[model samples]
Target: MCSASEGQSRRSPISTFSPGALRRVLRTADGVLVEAVYEPCTAGFEGNSPAAGGTAIVVAHGFTGSVDRPAVRRAARVFAQRAAVVTFSFRGHGRSGGRSTVGDREVLDLAAAVEWARSLGHPGVATVGFSMGGSVALRHAALHRGRTEARTDAVASVSAPARWYYRGTAPMRRLHWVVTRPTGRFVGRYGFRTRIHDRDWDPVPLSPVESVPLIAPTPLLVVHGDRDPYFPLDHPRMLAAAGAAELWLEPGMGHAENAADEPLLARLADWLVDAAARPRPAAPDAPRTA
Candidate 1:
């Protein structure tokens, strides 16, 4: 299994960020600890709150990424310019402990991270997730729609896969479908020695397309690279179609390109700030199941 550092040294097109940000280790009830970073903004943009600024954004890393991964770190800084930023590694990634559950348990880890951010006293909280982390963020929004403590004010998902089985015949999509599950099994068993979710629990079921609707009156921004291979451009559009969210098909953008594209970062920051400024929608009551 290749680590993010290995991918970086090889100069892959995936996004990369600078280092030396604030670090925190949060212990979970399961006794697993994860590494999270609080990235401070440079001296240019406004709003400086310890935790939740007037606007706060939590950036989540992709599969096999740590808090130090280039994309996550860069986004943290980007958002920090306008809002307080926090980035964290999922269990079994980076310096965090415990096994990987593909996307199943990672959602819970994300919820915990959000709680941590709220405890810091920020008024508005937005979650920005990439790839697999994108799916996790959408799921959290769906599951905790109206809860006051864990409410998600806004969301942005980049290169979020809407389905586990990529429908595209493109080589990358085909390759991902052919390899993702088997690789997940092999890596969890040997490389990371982690537990796999039960076969009955399909991670795709927790995808953004299904969860984005749950965000409801809470604003959402969905961006995908037009040229992305793993997930087709239509995915985010379909998500927007299912609900009232805004979709951006970044022209000529490819998977995870938001890290390197200054324009995209600017757009993201703009969305965050606008969402923060807009009158917040009253969280609808949580729906109780029969």
Candidate 2:
């Protein structure tokens, strides 16, 4: 998601051969149907070790992005080198059935993807999300609190805003208009091929910064670009500081998934692979009562 460089380039490696992809209509915990593609690992499932064996990766795309997008497929190809890969279009994006709730209800969509990864016999799962999807990954992992099958052992978020309602950049400003104004929504549907619902968040969902604290003990990697127009360095800094997580700030990167190059993704895959070798984290401490 580099600024002008990314926006100007319209090239992606074409997928020549299919990789055992199976299409599925996954119903989220809240009853939304998510269109997903699951590609079994080429190396076979290596059980629950993050190091030597095989794990699974669930790829979450950014706003206006889908599983079929060349970017998403390229990412899947990278992660599939070491594990099973499940890529899905968030509700309201592609063939998924529902209007986008932006990031609020989207956590359910991510949870469903994570659960699906575990159900496929992979003992370890990592959720890699970009931009809006990145925010959802953080919140969804926090919500699990390492308590259920939906728990994602590790998470990597790229170019995600630490908090919401930011309009510091031109792209973000335009994005706000698209999400908040009827005229912009109409444009989003027709111009961007996205279908977002018309509903204000009744009660604001947990912000990404707040979710970071709750995600600790589960390994987290926060990746952002200093050149990214949407969010400044403060965003990833806050996330890393709160979660005690690792952060990688590339020098000239742009937005979310598109910001990540193949080498960067390979490094992330290495991190996830290393996480798989480590033992599962202990259950999160019980919440103390006042």
Question: What C-alpha lDDT values do all the predictions have?
Answer: 0.65, 0.78
Q: Per-residue lDDT tens digits of candidate 1, residues 1-290?
A: 12222253222222343233456887754667887866544434334435335666787776666676555555666676777777888886766888666566677677667777777777777887787787777777777678656667888778777765555646444334323577745654454333344354442455567777778878888888877756776788788887878888888876763333766886787797687567765777654210
Q: What TM-score does prediction 1 earn?
A: 0.80
Candidate 2 residue-wise lDDT at 66: 78
lDDT score, candidate 1: 0.65
User: Can you give the lDDT of residue 13 in candidate 1?
Assistant: 26
The reply for model 2, stretches above 4 Å from the true place, is 1-17, 43-53, 285-290
Per-residue lDDT of candidate 2, residues 206-265 (tens digit): 899998988878888999988888899999999999967999999898888877889888
- Per-residue lDDT for 158 in model 1? 80
**What's the residue-level lDDT of 285 in candidate 1?**
60
Clashes of each: 3, 8
